[model samples]
Target: MKTRRVFLQRAGISAVALAMPTLNPLLAMTKSADPLKNYAQTLRVAIMGLGSYGTRVAEAIQSCTRTKLVGVISGTPSKVVEWREKYGIPEKNCYNYENFDAIKDNPDIDAVYVITPNALHKDQVIRVAKAGKHAICEKPMAVNAADGQAMVDACKEAGVHLLIGYRMHFEPNTLEVVRMRKEGELGEIRFFQGLSGFVIGDPTQWRLDPELSGGGAMMDIGIYSINGARYMVGEEPIWVTAQEVKTDPVKFKEGVDETITFQLGFPSGAVASCLSTYNMNYLDRFYLNGSKGWAEMQPSTGYGPIKGTTHKGPLTEPIVTHQTVQMDEMAAIIFDGKEAEVPVNGAEGVKDMKIIDAIFKAIKTGGKVDLTFG
Candidate 1:
């Protein structure tokens, strides 16, 4: 196995291809055309963390006919001021961590997308919910299942929608594969393999910190494999067994996993083998084999034109930028009552977290851990 020295842990920013800039169909919206007249409704969003992924999403939202970036919530004054000048956000629409609660009174902002560190997601999303603004948070959703559930419950009580950032759930090629499986084109699913990882670069980065990151590679890139297995196999895992590997403990540190190999058994008798790591390269792949046919995506979960092939032929779905389609689809889901081909709601997020909790337990016990989802 090849090990790398650095990782792009930023959300929706790195995967495989510039990490390929996902190829997406450009919307009808243009600077010359008015979006209000073209689209039925619009979702005005404020991003909480001004990180690389947040900037990427903000850039994509510029082209969305139904989604608009109208505000920002950041702890750094420089980033806030930078976003204001660059995105043309108004002074009144700006907010910091301590004052974002005032958004409840500001009707102009429709939602807040929490892109903060892993451990911060629960509190930030709950606060966004309590403020009556819809909350869209980047995954895992939280550090653990309990925190994930708390965010979900808080949003439910606040009567606001809670959306987890599952960009691949809206990807064209991924959905094409899903459609094939759902329509019985893939036959009885039997196996799945997902490999996701990259090297860790800066040991001092927040991602390497136990408090902010909650964990290591598994908490970051590993999620792609876990989520992919469930969707590709069309079943949630009933049991999981995992083993951990650590190299250069000085960098990985305590509570931070270096690499992990895991197995998942589903109710349908299908099984999946997956690997998540922060110490390897040339990973990013997803494969599924069923009784009748099979599908494979090499650069599966990356940021591009996702490339894939199956027993039938190559997957040639219309390529759309990952973040662009995600934001547009999210707007439709929030405003037009449209359901996604794949779930991206809070419950979906919690299920992943529960499975992750089980994986960690299995690692500690060196035995299979059974999983049950509600």
Candidate 2:
């Protein structure tokens, strides 16, 4: 087994407050939050989805030193029973989907982890924010950019933090890539290629439903490429153009895309080509070409054991549970207000959603779509 280091414990102040003596000025401001009176207390969390990803998140939280899964929101009573038995949660900590808003009065859960389907994210996040709890929503943030904006506004107005689950932002290898890029290791990056996809097995799965998933592979799996494009270049995209193809209309209904190949032009003159699809297998990879040398990550965006190499050499870091580290950092940010190396808040997520929206539009119009983010 590889040795792992948890960065959250080294934070000087309560994770909610980033004004430690060692923090840089820029970091202090972005991570600033009121110091919790109970800085040493455990931050309680509610797992809203009992699906595969939600189950995995619950398991990962068990290893967290500063967070606890104290509540749940599930549509299935059987899952509630199983979770209560597995996690030692009481019945009061369990809630059905319809009555979950009453969690405001429970006082046990400090935050709600919205891990449900893509379309359900908006309403659930709003309810969590309205209930005066912080929200940590899964990626794509919402079905559309407008809904994404609404979730951000709701959380900001409620004075609760809104975090998106971009686990790679906190992963060691991924961070190393960001650091190397910033340090000029790749030397003036000019082009990038991001490939993210997986073969869909079940035709009847929610991921195929336009209403439930918002879109097909682009919404479900292609987001990795969208996010990869921005972080790899360290700049926002300014324009986009794309094309979509669907060989099976029965499996991929109207409003659901099967595969999309898109290009992004950044303000810094960097251009990126990306592919997102559900018909391919083991396709997660990212490559960057710069004036001097290049960097590439194979199995870049998959769930763990990420591998990468640059012109200098391959990544030497060992693989760790990305979710475990992510949850720990989120706890520090939520309760102690610690600043992440990069922002993982709703704003960051909205920027990516904006790009995804533009990609779809560009595909539909067969013309370039310009984008701007504030």
lDDT of candidates 1 onward, in order: 0.87, 0.84
Q: Mark the regions of model 2 whose C-alpha exceeds 4 Å error after superposition.
A: 1-39
In terms of lDDT, model 1 sits at 0.87
Residue 37 error, candidate 2, Å: 15
Per residue, candidate 2 scores C-alpha lDDT tens digits across 18-88 of 44332222121121233222236566899999999999999877766556799999999999999999999
Q: Count the backbone clashes (under 3 Å) in each candidate.
A: 8, 9
The CA root-mean-square deviation of candidate 1, after full C-alpha superposition on the true structure, stands at 9.6
TM-score of each: 0.92, 0.90
TM-score of 1: 0.92
Clashing pairs in 1: 6-199, 6-201, 7-199, 17-20, 22-304, 23-320, 24-320, 24-321
What tens digits encode model 1's per-residue C-alpha lDDT throughout 87-173?
Answer: 999999999999999998998998999999999999999999889888999988999999999999998787778999999998889
Worst 10 residues of 2 by lDDT: 23-32
